[model samples]
Target: MFKLAGQLASDCIVLGDFQLCTLLLMNDAQYPWFILVPRREDATEIFQLSVADRSLLMEESCLLAEKLKDAFAADKMNIAALGNVVSQLHVHHVVRYRKDHAWPAPVWGKSPAVSYTPELLNERIGKLRAVLTNGFTFAESCP
Candidate 1:
Protein backbone atom coordinates (compact mmCIF):
# COMPACT_ATOMS: atom_id res chain seq x y z
CA MET A 1 0.00 0.00 0.00
CA PHE A 2 1.11 3.51 -0.73
CA LYS A 3 0.62 6.46 1.55
CA LEU A 4 1.06 10.09 0.58
CA ALA A 5 3.91 11.95 2.20
CA GLY A 6 2.76 13.96 5.22
CA GLN A 7 4.14 17.23 3.90
CA LEU A 8 2.43 16.75 0.55
CA ALA A 9 -0.91 15.95 2.12
CA SER A 10 -0.68 19.09 4.22
CA ASP A 11 0.51 21.39 1.42
CA CYS A 12 -1.61 20.24 -1.52
CA ILE A 13 -5.23 19.71 -2.41
CA VAL A 14 -5.97 16.22 -3.70
CA LEU A 15 -7.29 16.60 -7.20
CA GLY A 16 -7.59 12.95 -8.08
CA ASP A 17 -5.64 10.05 -9.54
CA PHE A 18 -4.47 8.83 -12.89
CA GLN A 19 -3.85 5.17 -13.65
CA LEU A 20 -0.47 5.17 -11.91
CA CYS A 21 -0.23 8.51 -10.12
CA THR A 22 -2.22 10.68 -7.76
CA LEU A 23 -2.66 14.23 -8.96
CA LEU A 24 -2.30 17.03 -6.46
CA LEU A 25 -2.71 20.77 -6.77
CA MET A 26 -0.28 22.77 -4.69
CA ASN A 27 -2.31 25.02 -2.41
CA ASP A 28 -0.37 28.09 -3.42
CA ALA A 29 -2.57 30.47 -5.40
CA GLN A 30 0.40 32.39 -6.78
CA TYR A 31 0.79 29.97 -9.65
CA PRO A 32 -0.95 26.94 -11.12
CA TRP A 33 1.33 24.30 -9.67
CA PHE A 34 0.55 20.60 -9.68
CA ILE A 35 2.25 17.35 -8.68
CA LEU A 36 2.00 13.78 -9.92
CA VAL A 37 2.98 11.17 -7.41
CA PRO A 38 3.37 7.57 -8.48
CA ARG A 39 1.32 5.15 -6.43
CA ARG A 40 4.32 3.03 -5.64
CA GLU A 41 5.50 2.19 -2.19
CA ASP A 42 8.91 3.33 -0.97
CA ALA A 43 9.96 4.73 -4.29
CA THR A 44 11.84 8.02 -4.18
CA GLU A 45 13.31 8.16 -7.67
CA ILE A 46 11.98 7.60 -11.18
CA PHE A 47 14.71 5.05 -11.79
CA GLN A 48 13.36 2.99 -8.96
CA LEU A 49 10.24 2.23 -11.00
CA SER A 50 10.01 -0.75 -13.31
CA VAL A 51 10.42 -0.10 -17.01
CA ALA A 52 6.70 -0.10 -17.71
CA ASP A 53 6.00 2.12 -14.74
CA ARG A 54 8.62 4.60 -15.87
CA SER A 55 7.05 4.81 -19.32
CA LEU A 56 3.61 5.30 -17.84
CA LEU A 57 4.93 8.08 -15.62
CA MET A 58 6.34 9.91 -18.59
CA GLU A 59 3.10 9.57 -20.51
CA GLU A 60 1.06 10.83 -17.59
CA SER A 61 3.50 13.70 -17.05
CA CYS A 62 3.32 14.85 -20.65
CA LEU A 63 -0.45 14.75 -20.65
CA LEU A 64 -0.51 16.82 -17.48
CA ALA A 65 1.96 19.38 -18.81
CA GLU A 66 0.05 19.83 -22.07
CA LYS A 67 -3.30 20.18 -20.35
CA LEU A 68 -1.93 22.67 -17.81
CA LYS A 69 -0.23 24.77 -20.47
CA ASP A 70 -3.44 25.14 -22.43
CA ALA A 71 -5.69 25.57 -19.41
CA PHE A 72 -3.53 28.24 -17.78
CA ALA A 73 -2.24 29.87 -20.96
CA ALA A 74 1.18 29.65 -19.44
CA ASP A 75 4.17 31.43 -20.93
CA LYS A 76 6.34 28.51 -19.92
CA MET A 77 5.88 25.13 -18.32
CA ASN A 78 8.32 24.12 -15.62
CA ILE A 79 8.50 20.40 -14.94
CA ALA A 80 10.89 18.79 -12.51
CA ALA A 81 11.31 15.85 -10.16
CA LEU A 82 13.58 17.09 -7.42
CA GLY A 83 12.97 15.01 -4.29
CA ASN A 84 15.31 16.93 -2.02
CA VAL A 85 12.62 17.82 0.51
CA VAL A 86 9.92 15.15 0.08
CA SER A 87 11.49 11.87 -0.91
CA GLN A 88 8.53 10.69 -2.93
CA LEU A 89 8.61 9.84 -6.61
CA HIS A 90 6.59 12.88 -7.61
CA VAL A 91 6.87 15.19 -10.60
CA HIS A 92 6.02 18.90 -10.48
CA HIS A 93 4.29 20.73 -13.29
CA VAL A 94 4.23 24.46 -12.75
CA VAL A 95 2.56 26.92 -15.11
CA ARG A 96 4.58 30.08 -15.42
CA TYR A 97 3.88 33.51 -16.81
CA ARG A 98 6.43 36.02 -17.99
CA LYS A 99 4.99 38.65 -15.68
CA ASP A 100 4.67 36.37 -12.71
CA HIS A 101 6.23 37.26 -9.36
CA ALA A 102 9.34 35.19 -10.05
CA TRP A 103 9.63 35.29 -13.80
CA PRO A 104 12.70 33.83 -15.50
CA ALA A 105 13.54 32.11 -12.23
CA PRO A 106 12.38 29.03 -10.40
CA VAL A 107 9.33 29.47 -8.17
CA TRP A 108 10.92 27.80 -5.21
CA GLY A 109 12.13 30.03 -2.36
CA LYS A 110 11.54 33.14 -4.41
CA SER A 111 8.54 34.33 -2.39
CA PRO A 112 6.04 33.10 0.13
CA ALA A 113 3.16 31.00 -1.08
CA VAL A 114 -0.08 32.91 -1.50
CA SER A 115 -2.89 30.68 -0.35
CA TYR A 116 -6.19 30.46 -2.18
CA THR A 117 -9.44 31.82 -0.90
CA PRO A 118 -12.43 29.50 -0.64
CA GLU A 119 -14.07 30.72 -3.84
CA LEU A 120 -10.86 30.91 -5.83
CA LEU A 121 -9.84 27.51 -4.64
CA ASN A 122 -13.12 26.07 -5.75
CA GLU A 123 -12.83 27.77 -9.12
CA ARG A 124 -9.32 26.49 -9.65
CA ILE A 125 -10.29 22.96 -8.73
CA GLY A 126 -13.31 23.07 -11.00
CA LYS A 127 -11.26 24.39 -13.89
CA LEU A 128 -8.66 21.69 -13.47
CA ARG A 129 -11.19 18.93 -13.09
CA ALA A 130 -12.86 20.03 -16.27
CA VAL A 131 -9.67 19.92 -18.30
CA LEU A 132 -7.96 16.86 -16.82
CA THR A 133 -9.98 14.26 -18.62
CA ASN A 134 -9.24 10.81 -20.19
CA GLY A 135 -8.13 8.55 -17.36
CA PHE A 136 -8.29 11.25 -14.71
CA THR A 137 -10.78 11.00 -11.89
CA PHE A 138 -11.66 13.87 -9.57
CA ALA A 139 -11.46 13.23 -5.87
CA GLU A 140 -14.86 13.32 -4.20
CA SER A 141 -13.34 15.31 -1.35
CA CYS A 142 -9.99 16.83 -0.62
CA PRO A 143 -7.91 15.80 2.38
Candidate 2:
Protein backbone atom coordinates (compact mmCIF):
# COMPACT_ATOMS: atom_id res chain seq x y z
CA MET A 1 0.00 0.00 0.00
CA PHE A 2 1.13 3.57 -0.71
CA LYS A 3 1.52 6.08 2.06
CA LEU A 4 2.07 9.83 1.94
CA ALA A 5 5.32 11.13 3.36
CA GLY A 6 4.87 12.54 6.86
CA GLN A 7 6.45 15.88 5.94
CA LEU A 8 4.12 16.28 2.99
CA ALA A 9 1.01 15.40 4.97
CA SER A 10 1.96 18.00 7.55
CA ASP A 11 2.89 20.72 5.07
CA CYS A 12 0.10 20.38 2.53
CA ILE A 13 -3.65 20.05 2.29
CA VAL A 14 -5.21 17.27 0.25
CA LEU A 15 -6.60 18.87 -2.91
CA GLY A 16 -7.73 15.94 -4.99
CA ASP A 17 -6.61 12.99 -7.11
CA PHE A 18 -5.86 12.28 -10.71
CA GLN A 19 -5.70 8.92 -12.44
CA LEU A 20 -2.36 7.92 -10.89
CA CYS A 21 -1.45 10.79 -8.53
CA THR A 22 -2.80 12.43 -5.42
CA LEU A 23 -2.88 16.20 -5.77
CA LEU A 24 -1.82 18.34 -2.82
CA LEU A 25 -1.89 22.06 -2.21
CA MET A 26 1.16 23.36 -0.43
CA ASN A 27 -0.25 25.21 2.59
CA ASP A 28 1.81 28.27 1.77
CA ALA A 29 -0.28 31.19 0.55
CA GLN A 30 2.67 33.07 -0.92
CA TYR A 31 2.26 31.33 -4.23
CA PRO A 32 -0.07 28.93 -5.93
CA TRP A 33 2.08 25.85 -5.41
CA PHE A 34 0.86 22.32 -5.92
CA ILE A 35 2.27 18.81 -5.84
CA LEU A 36 1.39 15.63 -7.67
CA VAL A 37 2.44 12.44 -5.93
CA PRO A 38 2.20 9.10 -7.66
CA ARG A 39 0.27 6.50 -5.71
CA ARG A 40 3.03 3.94 -5.97
CA GLU A 41 4.67 2.27 -3.03
CA ASP A 42 8.37 2.87 -2.43
CA ALA A 43 8.84 4.75 -5.68
CA THR A 44 11.48 7.40 -5.15
CA GLU A 45 12.30 8.43 -8.69
CA ILE A 46 10.57 8.99 -12.00
CA PHE A 47 12.58 6.13 -13.49
CA GLN A 48 11.11 3.88 -10.80
CA LEU A 49 7.66 4.24 -12.31
CA SER A 50 6.43 1.84 -14.99
CA VAL A 51 6.65 3.06 -18.59
CA ALA A 52 2.91 3.68 -18.71
CA ASP A 53 2.99 5.47 -15.39
CA ARG A 54 5.85 7.69 -16.53
CA SER A 55 3.91 8.71 -19.59
CA LEU A 56 0.78 9.31 -17.57
CA LEU A 57 2.73 11.40 -15.09
CA MET A 58 4.02 13.63 -17.86
CA GLU A 59 0.53 14.11 -19.23
CA GLU A 60 -0.86 14.98 -15.84
CA SER A 61 2.01 17.37 -15.12
CA CYS A 62 1.52 19.22 -18.38
CA LEU A 63 -2.22 19.45 -17.93
CA LEU A 64 -1.73 20.79 -14.42
CA ALA A 65 0.82 23.35 -15.57
CA GLU A 66 -1.49 24.66 -18.27
CA LYS A 67 -4.47 24.87 -15.97
CA LEU A 68 -2.49 26.66 -13.27
CA LYS A 69 -0.96 29.10 -15.72
CA ASP A 70 -4.38 30.08 -16.96
CA ALA A 71 -6.02 30.07 -13.57
CA PHE A 72 -3.43 32.31 -11.97
CA ALA A 73 -2.37 34.27 -15.04
CA ALA A 74 1.13 33.30 -14.11
CA ASP A 75 4.16 34.84 -15.73
CA LYS A 76 5.84 31.46 -15.56
CA MET A 77 5.15 27.98 -14.31
CA ASN A 78 7.98 26.28 -12.46
CA ILE A 79 7.77 22.49 -12.51
CA ALA A 80 10.34 20.23 -10.92
CA ALA A 81 10.80 16.84 -9.22
CA LEU A 82 13.76 17.36 -6.92
CA GLY A 83 13.41 14.74 -4.15
CA ASN A 84 16.36 15.89 -2.07
CA VAL A 85 14.24 16.55 1.01
CA VAL A 86 11.25 14.20 0.52
CA SER A 87 12.08 10.98 -1.28
CA GLN A 88 8.54 10.41 -2.50
CA LEU A 89 8.11 10.58 -6.26
CA HIS A 90 6.25 13.85 -6.44
CA VAL A 91 6.23 16.68 -8.99
CA HIS A 92 5.84 20.36 -8.07
CA HIS A 93 3.91 22.93 -10.09
CA VAL A 94 4.44 26.51 -8.93
CA VAL A 95 2.74 29.50 -10.46
CA ARG A 96 5.07 32.45 -10.64
CA TYR A 97 4.59 36.14 -11.26
CA ARG A 98 7.09 38.78 -12.37
CA LYS A 99 6.39 40.84 -9.28
CA ASP A 100 6.45 37.97 -6.83
CA HIS A 101 8.66 38.04 -3.76
CA ALA A 102 11.31 35.86 -5.36
CA TRP A 103 11.06 36.50 -9.05
CA PRO A 104 14.49 35.64 -10.43
CA ALA A 105 15.33 33.18 -7.65
CA PRO A 106 13.61 29.87 -6.98
CA VAL A 107 10.89 29.86 -4.37
CA TRP A 108 12.79 27.46 -2.11
CA GLY A 109 14.85 29.05 0.68
CA LYS A 110 14.19 32.50 -0.74
CA SER A 111 11.57 33.42 1.84
CA PRO A 112 9.41 31.90 4.51
CA ALA A 113 6.13 30.24 3.53
CA VAL A 114 2.98 32.11 4.51
CA SER A 115 0.12 29.78 5.35
CA TYR A 116 -3.44 30.62 4.30
CA THR A 117 -6.39 31.36 6.53
CA PRO A 118 -9.33 28.97 6.31
CA GLU A 119 -11.35 31.29 4.08
CA LEU A 120 -8.43 32.08 1.79
CA LEU A 121 -7.53 28.44 1.58
CA ASN A 122 -11.05 27.52 0.55
CA GLU A 123 -11.15 30.28 -2.04
CA ARG A 124 -7.86 29.20 -3.52
CA ILE A 125 -9.01 25.58 -3.61
CA GLY A 126 -12.25 26.63 -5.27
CA LYS A 127 -10.35 28.45 -8.03
CA LEU A 128 -8.19 25.38 -8.56
CA ARG A 129 -11.17 23.03 -8.55
CA ALA A 130 -12.89 25.18 -11.14
CA VAL A 131 -10.00 24.71 -13.55
CA LEU A 132 -8.88 21.20 -12.63
CA THR A 133 -11.82 19.29 -14.05
CA ASN A 134 -12.37 16.37 -16.43
CA GLY A 135 -9.80 13.81 -15.21
CA PHE A 136 -9.51 15.47 -11.80
CA THR A 137 -11.61 14.71 -8.72
CA PHE A 138 -11.74 17.18 -5.83
CA ALA A 139 -11.06 15.91 -2.36
CA GLU A 140 -14.07 15.56 -0.07
CA SER A 141 -12.27 17.18 2.85
CA CYS A 142 -9.12 19.35 2.90
CA PRO A 143 -8.13 19.30 6.54
In candidate 1, position 103 carries an lDDT of 95
Q: Candidate 1 lDDT, tens digit per residue, 41-129?
A: 99999999999999999999999999888888999999999999999889999999999999999999999998889988988777787
Candidate 2 — which pairs collide? none
lDDT of 2 by residue, 24-128 (tens): 999899999999999999999999999999999999999999999998899999999999999999999999999999997899988888999988887888788
Tell me the lDDT of candidate 1: 0.92
- In model 2, the runs with Cα more than 4 Å from the true position are none
C-alpha lDDT of residue 14 in model 1: 89
Give the TM-scores of the predictions, in the order they appear.
Answer: 0.96, 0.97
Q: Which ten residues in a row have the lowest lDDT in candidate 2?
A: 134-143
Clashing pairs in 1: none
